[model samples]
Target chain A: MAIIKRYRALIILSIILLGLSLISPERGTQALSLTSASLIDMFSLLPPILVLVGLIDQWVDKQVLIKFMGDDSKFLGVIIALLLGGLAAGPLYIAFPIAITLLKKGANIRYVVFFLGVWTTAKLPIVLFEVAAFGWKYTLIHVSVGLIFFYLVGVFFEKRFDPNTLLKEDITSNE
Target chain B: MSQSIFLYGLIAILTGLSWFKDRQKTKKALMKAKNILVKLAPELLAILLFVGLSLSILTPETISSLIGERSGVIGVFIASFIGTFAMLPSFVVFPLADTLVSNGAGLVQVSAFIATLVSVGFASLPMERRIFGKEFTYMRNLSAMLMAFIFSFIIWVVLPWL
Candidate 1:
C-alpha cells in the first residue's frame, strides 16, 4: 500500500499512456504510434535490467568502487569511468541503477558525470553498427569526436553543478 | 587462436580482480537482477507487442513524409531534433535509416538522427531523473542536442568533400 502510494503518479501516468495506446491512437501520426511503441518497448527492458542492477547495487560494497572513482584524482578515475561506461552493454536505462549505486558507494561526481555521458554517447554496439553502415573512417570520426566531446561536456557539467547541492535525492536514498 | 587466448586471459584477470574486491557484491547484484527480470518479463512482452504492432501498422512512406527531405541541412536539423522525441532501438532505426538513405534522405541527417535517438531522447527521461538526478539529466540532454546538430553539420559538410 505504501509502495503504491509512493509511486502513484508513475502508476497513474503509465496507466494513462497504456490506455491511450490501446484506444484512440491519433490518425496519420505514425510518428506518434511508433514513438509510443518504442517507449513501451524501452520501458519493458527497464524493469528487469534495473532490478538486476538494483540488486547488485544493494549487495556490492562501496569501498572498492569509491577508491576507483574517488575525488582524490580526476584523470585516472574519469578514464576508468568512461571506459567502464562505454564497454557496458544494455540500454541506458540499465546503466542508471549501476551509476546510482556507484554514487552511493562514494564515486566522485565527475566520474559519474563521465560515465553517464559516455554511457549514452559512445555505445560500442552502436558504433559497430555505424561502422558497418557507414565506413570505418566515418564511424571513427564520429566516435572519436564524440568521446572527446562527451568527456569535455561531462567535466564541464560536473564543475558547473556541485552535485551535492543540486542532487537532492542523494540525501534521502542510499539505494 | 592466440589472440583469443590473450583476450580470455585478460578477461580472466579482470574478473579475478573484481572478485578479489567484492565477490559477494557481484553475486548479490546478479541475484537482484534475476528478481527484477522475473518481475519485468511480462512488461517486456507487452512492450514488444506494442513495438511490432506500431511498426507494422506504419508504412515507410509515413515515416519518410515526416523526416525525409532533400533540403540538405534543414532536413537534417529537423530529423535530429525530432529524433529527440522519437524513441527506437538502434536495430530498428538502422533498417529504417537504410531505407531512408536509399529513398532520398542524406547520410549526415540519418547519422545525426541516430545520434540524437540514442543520446538525448525523451525515452530515458524518467530513468535519468531517477538515477543521475534532474540537473545532470537536463544538462546532458541539452548538450547532446546541441552536439547532435553540430555533428550532423560536420558529417554533411565533410561527407561531400571526402
Candidate 2:
C-alpha cells in the first residue's frame, strides 16, 4: 500500500508511456532508454552527495550554520552562497536537496536561494569550459551577469517567501 | 565517471572520520542518510520519467533548428519556452549551445536558451512544488524565465559591444 502511494506518479507516467508506445513504438523506446539512463545517472550522482549532507547535518552545529550563512551573516553569507554554488558539480535538481539541507541547518533563506541561483550558471569547471568554448567575453558576461542578477532575485525571494512555510511541508509529511 | 568516483571517495573518508570521532553519531548519520533517500526517491523517479518522455520528442536537433539566427526575436521566445521546459546538465548545456550557435543559431537566441535552461525548471515543477510549496515554485520559475529574457537582451547588446 505504501509502495503504491509512493510510486503513484511513476505508475501514471509509465501508463502514459505505454499508451504512447501503442501509438509510436519509436518514441516510446527512446523515452524508456533515456529514462533508464537518467536513472543510472541519478543513482550514481546522488547517494554520496546526499550522504555527505547527512553527515554534515549530524556534525555541524545549527549555531555554526547560522553564524556563517544565516540571516545576519550578510556579506559573508553572500560569499558563502556563491562559493557553494560555483564549486559544485551536478544537475540543477541536485541543488534543491542540498539547499534544503542547509536551510534546515539554519542557513539564511537569502543565501539558500542565492546558492541555488549560482549553481545554474557559475559552476567553476563549467565556467572554465565556457571560457574555452565560447571565449572570454561571452563567458565573462554570462557569469557576471548571471551571478549579479541571481543575487538580486535571491533578495527578492527572501522578501517574498517565508522559509517556514516552505519547510513546514516537511513536518507534516513526517507525521 | 570521475565526478562520481571523487564523491564516493570523499564520502568514504568523511564517513570513516566521522566513525572515528563517535561511532554512535556516525550510525545515526548513516540512518539519516537512508531516511532522506527513501523520502526523496519517489518524487525523483517521477521527475526522471517525465523528463524522459519530454526529451524523447524535444530532441536537441529539433531545438537547434527552431532557434536559428534568422528566427530573431521569435527564435529567442521559442528558445526560452524550450529552455524553460527542458532540463540538461551544465556540461551538456554549453556544448549544445555551442553546436546551435555553430549551426548558425543566433547568439541572443542561444543565450536565451542557455539562460532559461539553467535557471528555469518547468518539468521539475511537480517535484519542486512537493518540497517548496506551490506558490514559491511558480513564482521562482516565472522570475527565472523573466530573468532569462532580460539577460539574453543584455548579451545581445553587450557581448557585441564588448
Clashing pairs in 1: A52-B33, A56-B29
lDDT of 1 by residue, A1-175 (tens): 9566445445554564556556745532443555466655455445444544544465456676666887775677877877877766555555666676666677777777678667766667666666677777777767766777777886787678775554456412324
True contacts kept of 2: 0.61
State each model's C-alpha RMSD to the native. 6.4, 2.3
The digit string of per-residue lDDT tens for model 2 on A48-153 reads 8777877887899999999999989999999999899998988877777788778888987889888988898889988887887789888888888877877888
Superposed on the true interface residues, model 2 gives a C-alpha RMSD in angstroms of 2.4
Candidate 1, B26-113: lDDT as tens digits = 5555565555445333334333333434354445665566566565677777777657756556555666777777776677777777
Q: Candidate 2 DockQ category?
A: medium
Residue A103 local lDDT, model 1: 68
* Over 4 Å off, model 2: A1-12, A171-175
Q: What is the TM-score of each candidate against the true structure?
A: 0.70, 0.92
lDDT (tens digit, per residue) of candidate 2 on B16-51: 999999999888778777776677777888878877
